[model samples]
Target: MSFKSIVRELKEMRDGIGSTSRRGGSGSRHWHSRTKSHIVPDVTLAPLEHVQQGQWANLPFDLLVDIIRRVEESETTWPARAVVVSCASVCKSWRAVTKEIVKTPEQCGRLTFPISLKQPGPRDSPFQCFIRRNRETSTYLLYFGLVPSENETDKLLLAAKKIRRATGTDFIISLVADDFSRSSNTYIGKLRSNFLGTKFTVYDSQPPHGAGMQLNSRSSRRFHSKQVSPRVPAGNYVVSTIAYELNVLRTRGPRRMQCTMNSIPISAIQEGGSAPTPTSFPQIIDKHFSPSPAAKGKGLISDLNHATLSEVPVQSEGSLEGLVLKNKAPRWHEQLQCWCLNFKGRVTVASVKNFQLVAAVDPSHNVSPAEQEKVILQFGKIGKDIFTMDYRYPLSAFQAFALCLSSFDTKPACE
Candidate 1:
């Protein structure tokens, strides 16, 4: 009748059943005996209810702001920007919070070109210049649009037409891969631009020895003599060392590109010594191009103010340094499982077709958090055969473009 009385009767019924089960000869009880004796107790307990949901939106504003700041500062991967954007889209409350957090340019990551680049069409919006890579071939076509047009496609097409007609060169730079796989891993390729193509090679001279057997007289003899030994081909050697070289193809002779990785500490290695220490940070260097003989003594001396017309000193090999590369330290990316560079936060995973070229800073010195916030150059994907480069510096557009192109190589991480 009463709540307490009914509860006592249910407990007494349960205890009686337990006592009978324990005294039985067999350990196992029948289905009828196991059945709960109390189907519905006379007592009416409180009805079940749902627990109240958490009030995440009601969290202190300052605490929320701190949480977002930590996330923005720590997330340095490729999808970091996407994660921030996602937070903004969660709800109006979150959106307002994120908006305040990203007000500073440094707080917001650099602009990205998510889509692969495509050739500019007549009606497409105009860009300063366009770098097009052929999908079917390993050729990169550089278009320097001298004529500025409202339409980006028209500008690129016009520039290509004018340069081709004047120089009789298509401005096509073909990348010929040495390896059969044609992947960026290791290859010797010719970067044919204008009429003369430059030869550049990226190869792993000292590959890891663990992956394959070294092809030597001793190993060959051991394999041949042992009937059970598996034959390993000479070509099955792994590359352990990596080197890059560029050669300028000239009419008279092929001159090695006069360049050096500046600011890199030179460590002397003894003959037949251990491997040379690997560079920690990427190096930036100036490339000097020897003046063409034909251009010598051709300048008019009359115009004192005309710097272009004045004869440049013979000793002064024009610095192609503006177009020179500013190499960032290649980092091991765990997600992409590749070696990449964060060029002022513009590029995460470096590729030949996609990379950023920022101003060269001392590698030994760490960049101040405030100074290293913005992007220097944003180059790479917009759509297929179409690429974008948003350069803020005063470097020559061609040189900047070329420097970005140089990054599309096989680095250690790629191997």
Candidate 2:
């Protein structure tokens, strides 16, 4: 039957039913006793035709792998492992693809641990390491995948410990290392932060057995017999220095921590240099609260007013060497009523224990308002006692690594 004819017949049947109902009901009380019935459609829908789907599912497996590879190689792959793990959960095929491209520990950059920290696994185990804080001693512990089996667990087996002293803005840390026997400890070097955490000085402590001292002498034997070693030499044994430049500053709020690390000069540490005296913590706090004397005088006020009208330098983006990094220095925030560093750019959030050291053409610049600044190093937190560093071309791996260790100046949770 045609659709139009079927529809007309249904409409007529509905009209007849309505009329019959009206006729059955009419007399007074009987009008209210009429019965009604519901009508439902009895039509069936036709099945849909099959069509082609998107080609994404049919993409070559190698092509998908190439896409992932590019992402892994990017500079912003800080949380790369987490991103890859997420991709694995997308589908069975993606999971298989990601597994093949996963980076092993040897392939990835090194994971550093704070001094005195212990790892929590079998000594001979492989890539991952766990780090935790020791609340009682206010110290950090590091654990690695593989440690020598003969190394005693009870004693602190530390290659180096970079500590942020309880009191200074200076990144000064006490370092101790195992003696030649690998059984006892010795004071090896002192890493001191300079130029407001922009540079560092490493001083080698004098050996306990000084030259010309008779080892078999009674005095020497008595000195060596003590459980704890004698105090380290306070003289000049400066070995190297590290300088850093602050490149980018990413700040969203006043509460978030602002930090970074960059490159060091080969010449800065070639011969020993004098360590800069650290400014006291109390002095830093007082300076933040104190108002400028220029605000108090009429003449100084006019000078300051003139200075405010001057144009400020705009940061330009370019190669790492050409980029200027300014140290805006900490300023008072009226809204926050707290001291804050003016990074002077869109603040990018950085993770803990991650840092980079970039070499710049000019490592030094005047701190005047008109001068363009350059960053020598950039560093940030990656994890507890862990950070990443990228130094300029001149620094050796050992020098860069030493400077990188000096960047951890913040107090850990245990403290």
Candidate 3:
């Protein structure tokens, strides 16, 4: 059977089960409620419920696995790929089988779940994404699919709103565009820059690794509101740092920049080397299940309190570092009288923000010449308020988005 047909049958059978449960006595209704209570009431799983005697939920184990495996293989893109997610959400047994069948983005070269945003991109080529900017609100939206026309809409992977402060500037990123507040459950992470905007730090809402929550004294003083969920960590974990070289004199032809991905190791650039990829999401207090709006806000409010107003520290050149990215120099185009880097038609228009990134090799490490030539991430303008961002393995969408947002900031010293 076709994947959609099988999904339709599951839904139709669920309706029958619901009708059966509703017509039964109070005991049957009580049992149905208990079953739903155990399942996470998220967008993916809320539609289906379990029943001990339901024929749909009792499909043969081997057949059920095969069907879902086919669904995963058939539907490979978003909106359509959501069916695969639905198959997993059907029941506990289905979820287990589906999880086993699904592979990480690095392995499959496809984004299948929310956790994929935190995982590495495909190994061979960079995953392509685009950003839409709302100039009036100073917000940026990141989409997974190709660049859509003005009227067309694509899947919004992440959003960020720019906020200026007396000390520095902040870019508040979240899953939803409307609500940019740190007190919202959709809040993911943020980027903070010093007054000059030359240095920026990327913060993750959860730890990059499996490290236990260790709140520093600095963070304790910042978070005045004691109300916070125990499940949520106390402070945002520093993941990476981005820096722009001071170019006030305009001696350089183009802007020079560098980024140190603290969460990724330098060894990742070596052949057959792997970087740390988070397999699952952190324990987030689901806003949908919260008893009250006020209760949900408390847990979400603790994220941005610990940001440092001073300059984000730059890793010393002498110290052993994680993966370092340096901007590829653009040659002066004599014909156009403008700087240029071969974006291969991905970029158009001459904007100072246009640039490509390649891994910087350390003298101590033996790195391949081909690896150094590969463009790990590249960002440039395609239209007004629209841009393309392509990133490869060792860099997640979250990290790539944060890095692109840095280019949007006004760097007085690095113009």
**Model 1: number of clashes?**
19
State the local distance difference test value for candidate 3: 0.72
lDDT of each: 0.30, 0.30, 0.72
Give every collision pair in model 3. Answer: none
Expressed as tens digits, the lDDT of each residue in 1-415 for candidate 2 is 4534533443454344335435653431121121111001000001111101222234478876875565445422222223333333333455456545643322344221111111111111222222333344433333332221244332122234444444333322222221212111122234566434555565433211111211334334433432322221222233344444443353422222222212222222222311111111111111222112221111111111111111111111111212222222445679967554322221233433333322222434322322222333333333443332332222222233444455454432211
Best by lDDT: 3
Q: lDDT value for candidate 2?
A: 0.30
Candidate 1, residues 1-415: lDDT per residue as tens digits? 5534533443454344345544653332321122221111101011111101123345578876776666556543333344444344333465567556643221132221110011111111222445665545544554433222355332121111111234222222211111222121111111112222232221121221111223455445543442221111111111111123342232221111211211111110111212112111001000111122321112211211111111111110122111123333345679977655543332333345454433343433343443233344456554555665554322223223433444343222222
Candidate with best TM-score: 3
- Candidate 3 all-Cα RMSD: 6.9
lDDT of 1: 0.30
lDDT by residue for model 3 (1-415), tens: 6756888876666556545755666655543443332221232233333443355477889999889888889888765676676676567677777878989999999887666788889979788889989999999999886675565536667889999999889998876666676654556689999999999999887666532333556554644444554334324667789999999999887889999987787777787677778776543432222322234333443333333222222232222467899999888889988887999888876788888999998667788988888999999999998899999988999999999999999987998
